[model samples]
Target: MELRHLRHFVAVAEEGHITRAAERLGMQQPPLSQRIKAIEDELNVQLFRRKPRGVELTEAGRVFLDRARATLAHYDGAFEATRSAARGEQGRLCIGVLPTTLFHPFVPLIIRAFRTTYPQVSVTLDECMRAEAIDGLRNQQLDIAFLRSAIDEEVDLNAYPLLNEPMVAALPSDHALARSGRDAQSLSLKDLADEQFILYARKLGPSFYEATMAACIRAGFTPRLGQEAPRITSALSLVAVGLGVSLVPACMQNMTMNGVVYRRLKGAVQPKAVLMIGLRRGDTSPVVRNYVSLVRKTAKTFRPSEKEAR
Candidate 1:
């Protein structure tokens, strides 16, 4: 029998009369009686006993009522859950983030805000390189990513700028400039002319590496490249070991590497560490949209500017 039959049976059982039950259900007495009959017939049992005064429940009717009530409660709960998901109040979101993002002060702030706002929604975060983040977004393996901007135009994704972090120079504590007291003030690229440079791997982003080289060229002489590291942390670690000085995002300053000191760089050509929120081109999940919005808001509150860092 259909849900309507169970509902009608329940109404009749509660009202103790078909005529009154039909009035309560906004229907005719005959149809309500027929629905109850259909349910009993399907179950092959009598669900009620009729007397001149009113109707009473049979032993079978008492057991069936409990089952019907439970079924209705289950349906109500399921409907509520589906509606919550549709409204972005519940669901799972997987986000891929660049390793450098963890160094940014605002990343954790945004995560905390998102967790508080959507307590019921499950969030999973993965630290990935820029290329891997791009691949994850394209393959639908991640709902969104926080990464550097300047993505390829051909990728099927949408990116919104989250923050712009200026680059800083990480120097060895005992280096000449560090000894001369010149490291405390904002430094021009010219100051690094005689210093050996540690470079980020070319594979990370050729354009970014090239930008660093260009900045050095504009300063007067090409920086002497002494070593290459695959990630920002590795580059800083090399600097800490007195391998060579390197220019890195200002956010890296938050990391305390022994013997490594961060100095502000001077020049009109500030290489920015941009944070972007990326999603598949056609993603329509409400949860993803809400998360993106929250990220944008958080970014606005704590976003760094080139002049501010300088």
Candidate 2:
């Protein structure tokens, strides 16, 4: 029988009178009685017994009533869950983030604000390299990504540029530069020209790699590469161990490496590293849309000092 039949049966059973049940259901008494009768007929069992002033439920009726109520509750709950998800109030958001992006203030700010607004939405973070994050987004393993560059090739994706800041140098704690009596803030790229560099792989994040090389070239020397890592954080780790100095996104200075110190590059023209959010083109997920909007808004309020980005 249809759900309407169960509802009619429940109303009549609860009221103990067809007339009262019809009033509660906003239907006529005769129609209510007919619906109740149809339910019993479908089940081939007597569900109600007529009385002088009202009706009484048969043993079969009591058992069926429990089932009907539970079914209704389940349907109601399912409907609410679907609606909430569509409204972006409930769902799981898988985010693929580059390690470098995590050090940026705006990224965490956006995530925290989004969580506050959508408390019911669960967020999962996947820390990955630029190429891995992009692959995750394209493969549907991730709903959105925070990365270093936009997709230059034709793809069904959209990249929203979030932050563009100047690169900074990461030096070992005992390195000559750190021990120099000169002001660390006034350190120049040209000064590090002769030092070995710990660099990020070209394919992993080409944008930052190119920027580092460009800045070194502008300083009149190609860097001596000593080691390369797939992620910026890893490069910094190498710098901390004194393998080589590294030029990283200024925001990456947020990472606390015990043996490393961050210094601004002194130059009139410095190369910049960029952070971008990538998602599928024409994505209709409400959760993803809300996150993207929140990121844009958060970026607006983020005012990093020129010194912070040096």
TM-score (all chains, Cα) for each model: 0.81, 0.81
| lDDT for each residue of candidate 1 in 133-181, tens digit (9 for 90 to 100) | 8899888899989877666684678888877778888899877766655
The per-residue C-alpha lDDT of model 2 at residue 238 equals 91
The sequence of per-residue lDDT tens digits that candidate 2 reaches over residues 60-134 is 999999999999889889999999999989998999988788888777778888999999999999988777777
Report how far residue 148 has shifted in candidate 2, in Å: 0.5
Global CA lDDT computed for model 2:
0.85
* Residue pairs in candidate 1 whose N, alpha carbon or C atoms collide under 3 angstroms: none
Flag regions of model 2 displaced more than 4 Å: 44-46, 49-58, 88-92, 112-122, 184-194, 217-226, 265-267, 303-310
